[model samples]
Target: MTSARDIVPISARLLERLEALGTPRDRVLAHAGLAATTALSTEQFFAFWRAVEEVSPRRDLGLVVGAEASERGYSVASAAALHAADLAGALHTLARYKRLTCPEVVELEVARGEAHVRFHWVLATSEVPRLLVDSTFASFTSLARRGTAGAVAPLRIELARAAGDAALLRERLGCPVAFGAPVDRITFAERALAARFVTADAEAFSRVVPGLEAELVGRSRTRSLRDEVRLVIARKMSSGARPSVDQVARGMHVSARTLQRRLGEERTSYQEQLDAVRRTSARRLLANTDLDPIDIAFLLGFEEPNSFVRAFRGWERTTPTRWRARVARG
Candidate 1:
């Protein structure tokens, strides 16, 4: 099971909404007891989440909190009101403030062509993935509504996997849903970029951006170390090298001891993380690349072809050669 420490900095807006539902703050904290004992184990957190869902007033609590925060003047919308000279400004505002609300999972990036938004959440036990997708769509819809054009529809929604509530998705988003896609993204048209917003309080927006970013940065520091470790391993493995803890620690500007301590806190180890990356990379390479076993071994940082064979057997319980043959025959 994953750990609650794995899902820190939950949507503050969602938490606020849950709190406002007349569920006492103590009850909420009790539900999140793992925060004190240890990072909530995945199973424990999920079970707690299920109980919350059973009593949750708004299933889309993130959206509800966002809306409430907008009203209270401490929200993404308020940040937009500060400098959102136009639609682009609003998106930039969201990208800046979103982290204060949810850490590590949802990310927003803007490029020349379009604004890219992604949500990679580890669902709390009580929460449903569909709720996340729906809430995200709704949140974006709220932002769109306040935009220059007053709520233009999204160009497309690509789902990494299908959700249980397809009909709810169709009704709420009113957009084409592409399931089983390699990545999940919501595409906004370039024209949507030119739309104008009614609110243009740049001075106010400027003041809020910094404070919000500071809070977000503070919250993110704790979660980022884990993600950084994962990223370092992935990058090293992708470059055809098996990185040691010391190597990764040096790269991350931390001592090996510190890295190990942090991973121990998260109930993982450097070696386990490295192995996970290698296994995942191996599967992708086997499925997509035409490289032979010995070459693949070298690419994965295996010094000996036999070592690669052994590792592959451990991962798949079959020889790499046989695995490739099976895939080919299929």
Candidate 2:
């Protein structure tokens, strides 16, 4: 029952996971009109996934990428989950705040001495992409493994996608992988739920949960014109995709002229918002990650590294490498 208004954007942390796997984060973000800093709506994220599926040669791209990702990619919810007393508490936290990550429904059902953690995509589309399901289950497994310090293992992994490379999933997860199921779900032993997290800190949860809850509340509120446009531009810029004014205007459900007029009233333009998002995102990536300048340029929607360099120079009066070094020094 997730609505467009309630759909959450893909987090920069999750996007970084794909970046680490050499998935050309820039193209993905650009196609979705998203920046690394912008959270993508479910529909926008789906478009990015379609773009990924179209280009990736491996049919198991989602599974492969998801397994290698770390809990750092889970963002604030991961922080809250990890602060819990045990795996059950962590799973519950994720299920409750699942909307913060995406529009998918997360359900934890306990029965017959087992816990079934099901992920359901409530899309209105004709069909759900297999890659999305694969990625979600794989990422969920990876996070669970990390949260429980490698002690937890899925009893079984089930997917709605047709069976493909089941052995690979089995090997990777150390559990049976079955497809063509009624839903996408992972089953774990009831005892696993009681297993304490290695990094557990109830006090930390007390301090962090309120802020995350508050953010969820705030996001559910209204967004400004600039905010909406910036998000669209960030998604579109992912893979060197230059978003057009008309495209953005259509996305916001308004005509181009009206969109432009409103932006003027807010003292900004489409290009200005795009530039600000890219610059801010580039600076963040440079300061926070070890990704090379070339990759950073690609993520910023530049056709070539030199273009990004030129733009960065214009913004910061120095090259990306030099700026990163400067950031490191301070």
Candidate 3:
């Protein structure tokens, strides 16, 4: 039997569709040995997918979900159908509709003569990062096959340090995969933009594209600003000192006002994100490291021991010394 750790959060829509296929929720949960109330961690989520592979070897659950979405009046066509002016337009379409079948954000950006696409996920419901990554790669490949064959060149994937299954990723992406990266990015050839869509379906897509775009925009705006802020702060903190909003704004090439406005849209502030990072880091350090309080404070960018003490109290409702001691004892 699969352990509880192997289950990942799945969308209710996807689950319902699966149920329609005679895949009962209890059976799925039983395969993972996870309770309905449990949220699967990333590791467990991947394991659950592996377990699924064992039980149903030939079926591609991700594709099944995509097909279900297409059946439900959602467009699952390639972006090449739009007669996209360039690869960028195609990417925009892909990013816009990627979530109709998958909940993760697939980011596309052009920098230094290359197109980079990254998959960012919250995993609030699903824990299978590999499944997410592979599904995204498959979607891109399907888009390429239908829209513009040979449009997608070899790509590079940037993944979180904790991500697993490098061998599977390499084989599936047909590209290099790098771990411990700040963001998950897939780099493709710039020349792929010249390829045209093989069979354009503009009229069919037109019926549903607007709604998809609107839904994507709403979700993009609502996603966690804290996570983005945490990433920025973590990068800066790793390199040197922790950055203020103004500094981070400059790094993001946006004005401080713009940064504030964007964060406000997501109902978060730079300072609050910083505090969360500090608190999370503090707990991790206290539990995992033997660093003294003064050292820990400095490492966390606290200039004074008293300030660290105050922050620790706010975060843990106890002193760092006491927290560390309790963890050690436990």
Ranking by TM-score: 2, 1, 3
Per candidate, the number of residue pairs that clash is 6, 24, 5
Best by TM-score: 2
Q: Mind giving the per-residue lDDT tens digits that candidate 2 earns over 1-330? A: 334354556656666666666677777666656554344455666667877776566777888766654455454565577777888888888776665666555667788899988765433232345677677778777777877889998999876554577887787767998765434579999899998888788788888888778877976574457767866665565324666788788878999999999999989888788777778768756765567788778777777899899999998999999998987899
Candidate 1 C-alpha error for residue 100, in Å: 3.1
Highest lDDT model number:
2
Shift of residue 48 alpha carbon in model 2, Å? 1.1
Give lDDT tens digits, candidate 1, residues 1-330. 443235333444455556777545446556645443224443454444554554566655534543344444444534454358766666666665554443324445556776656554322222233434455566665566655445567777776543444555555666676664433567777767667776676677667667776776666655545567766765565444667788799989999999999889979888777666566656645654555678777777777899988888998899988887897688
Error of 3 at 310 (Å): 13
Q: TM per model?
A: 0.55, 0.59, 0.54
Q: Candidate 1, residue 234: CA error in Å?
A: 8.0
Report the lDDT tens digits of candidate 3 across residue range 205-225.
677678777765765664455
Candidate ordering by lDDT (highest first) = 2, 3, 1
lDDT of 2 at 263: 97
Alpha carbon lDDT at 63, candidate 3: 49
Which stretches in model 1 have alpha-carbon errors above 4 Å? 1-83, 105-115, 121-128, 149-151, 216-226, 229-330
Clashing pairs for predicted structure model 3, backbone only: 5-44, 6-44, 9-125, 9-126, 147-197
